[model samples]
Target chain A: AQSVAQPEDQVNVAEGNPLTVKCTYSVSGNPYLFWYVQYPNRGLQFLLKYITGDNLVKGSYGFEAEFNKSQTSFHLKKPSALVSDSALYFCAVRDMAGTGRRALTFGSGTRLQVQP
Target chain B: GAGVSQTPSNKVTEKGKYVELRCDPISGHTALYWYRQSLGQGPEFLIYFQGTGAADDSGLPNDRFFAVRPEGSVSTLKIQRTERGDSAVYLCASSPDPAPNEQFFGPGTRLTVL
Candidate 1:
């Protein structure tokens, strides 16, 4: 089975400061990882995905994530945080070789709070 | 270029009742998925349909939960004997064929069971 772990329930950062939300995974084979953001009462919006190739993947809203194979982690990052970035974030994973199992497994979630 | 859409944004029902949630995937998307999001938790996979067939229903919790996509564009998730524990947000997503790198999700249907 594949799974994602988000250790922090909440992350706080001041405006213009850098921010990071950690995520790790456990899967049998290669993994397809993705990050999504959810605004209040809104559906999850795709942020980015790491299918293969580049280790550092850029996403919407000036967000990026690093895929560390050695660490089995994909941590979401932003150079400078904005108050509008405050929202719920989720990390999801899917086994590349898991036939017929295309559904993604998501982490519990991390709440990002950016203060002005 | 409309995104995925789900019907009945909110539904409230009593325990032991039956309910169905609908999902209209993005036009031309061959893959559709259903997930449940509990309060304070991320969305959990329930099922996945490729074309007109259910490629995966492994994530479904029990027999009471079922889903189907008849024409391959629209899907519906049916829950039988709904329990209070079933109350949560039902999220639908769709992706293009070949691979599902990024899924477009709908606003989700919030179900409240009393």
Candidate 2:
């Protein structure tokens, strides 16, 4: 079984400041990680994914996430926060080696509040 | 191209009633998935369909929760005897293929069972 944990329920950051939403995962084998953002009444939009590449992966909307093997973490980062960045963020993980289960396990979610 | 779409954006139903939710995936997508999102929580996988066959349905909570993707394009999720606890946003997503591809999600159908 695989699971994702986002410790912070909500993160508040000021505009123009850097922001980080933390995520950690546990899986039997290697993991494929992902980050998604959901605006009000909108479906989740793919931000980025970490399959098997550079630890630092860049994504849409100037967002990025670092895959730390030792710590089992994939924390989303942004160089500077904007008010428009306020939304609900989700972290998900899929086991590379599994019983042919393609389902992704997701974290509870983190609400990012970028205040002006 | 249009993204994954789900019909009946909102649904209010009485407990014990049957309800159906629909989904239309991207034009060329061959993989479809169903997930449920509770308030304040992230989406949880319910089922996965590869083409017209259900590749995985382990996430389904119970037998009452059923889904079908006939002809491998449009999908429908059927719930029998819907319970209050079943009230949640039924989300549908799709991808070109199963592995490594990121699933594109729909706006979701918010089901409210009273």
Candidate 3:
């Protein structure tokens, strides 16, 4: 089974400071990891994904995530946080070696709170 | 081009009522998906359709939940009997292919079962 875990239910960071939202995964084979952000009453917006590429993957809205295979983690990061950056973050994983199933298994989600 | 769009941005219904949610995938998109998201939780996969066929419906919780993508374009999700547990944001997403690609999501229909 492919699954993702967001250890933190909520993360708070000051504006202009770097912020990190942690995510870990477990899959039977090579994993396709993704990050998505959802704002109030809106659908989830894709941030970035790591299928088979460099360790660090940059995404929308000045956000990025590091795919650390050894640590089984894909933590979302931002160089500088802004108040508008606050939203619900989700980490998802798909098993590349699975039975051709492309449905993503998502984590519980982490709320990112960027304080001004 | 416009992204995936779902109808009835919000729906409120009493228990035991039958409801239908519609989704219009991006033009030419071959794949469509349905998911349910509860309060404080991430979206949970419900079903996936490839073309006009249901490629994968294993994620559906029970027989009460059903979906269809006729003509390989627009899709509809039907719930037989509404329950309080079914209250959540029903999301619809679409991808260009069946491969493991990034999916574009719609604003979602907020279903409130009263």
Candidate 4:
């Protein structure tokens, strides 16, 4: 079984300030982690994924996430926040090595509010 | 060059009625997936289709929920006896192949049972 945990229900960041949204994952084998953003009345858009090789992965919309193997954490980061970035963010994980080629397990998501 | 697409952007139905949601995956993507999203929650895996066959249906909640992709390009999810609990946004996604499961999502159909 694989699971993901996003501790915060909401995160507030000011425009032009750096932002960080936390995520942690649990999996039996190796973990394939991903981040997505959802605007109002819209489907989720893939932001970034960490499969292998690099601990730090950059994604779309000027967003990036760091995969910390030791702590089992993959935190999404942005060098500077923008007002348009306000949306719901989700963290997902899957067991890439599992036999099932299982579906991604998503966290309860965190709403980000970027104040201008 | 189009992304995944789903039909019936919004469906309002009475309880006990049957409703169907449709999805058209991107051209050439071999793997398609169906997921359900409730208010204030992330999408929940419902089914997975590889080619023309249903690769996995473990996430389907009950027998009333059925999905098919006979032609391998389009899929339909049918719900029998619509209930208030079944009201949610049904999302469809597709991926290329093999290792990367990076699914491209459709706008989804919001189903409401009255």
lDDT of all the models against the reference?
0.95, 0.95, 0.94, 0.92
lDDT, residue A7, model 2: 100
User: CA lDDT of B30 in candidate 1?
Assistant: 94
Query: What TM-score would you give candidate 3 relative to the actual structure?
Result: 0.98
Off by over 4 Å in 2: A98-100
The DockQ score of candidate 4 comes to: 0.72
lDDT of 3 by residue, B2-74 (tens): 9999999999999999999999999999999999999999999999999999999999999999999879999
* Higher-ranked by lDDT: 1 or 3: 1
lDDT value for model 2: 0.95
Model 4 alpha-carbon miss at residue B94, Å: 0.4
DockQ, each predicted model: 0.85, 0.91, 0.86, 0.72
Identify the runs in model 4 with alpha carbons over 4 angstroms from their true place. Answer: none
lDDT of 4 by residue, B1-114 (tens): 899999999999999999999999999988899999999888999998988898889999999999999988899999999999999999999988645668899999999999
- Residue B102's lDDT in candidate 1: 91
Model 4: clashing residue pairs? none
Docking class of 2: high
Positional deviation of B75 in candidate 3, in angstroms? 0.3
Give every collision pair in model 3. none
Which is better, 3 or 4, measured by lDDT? 3
TM-score of 2: 0.98
Ranking by TM-score: 2, 1, 3, 4
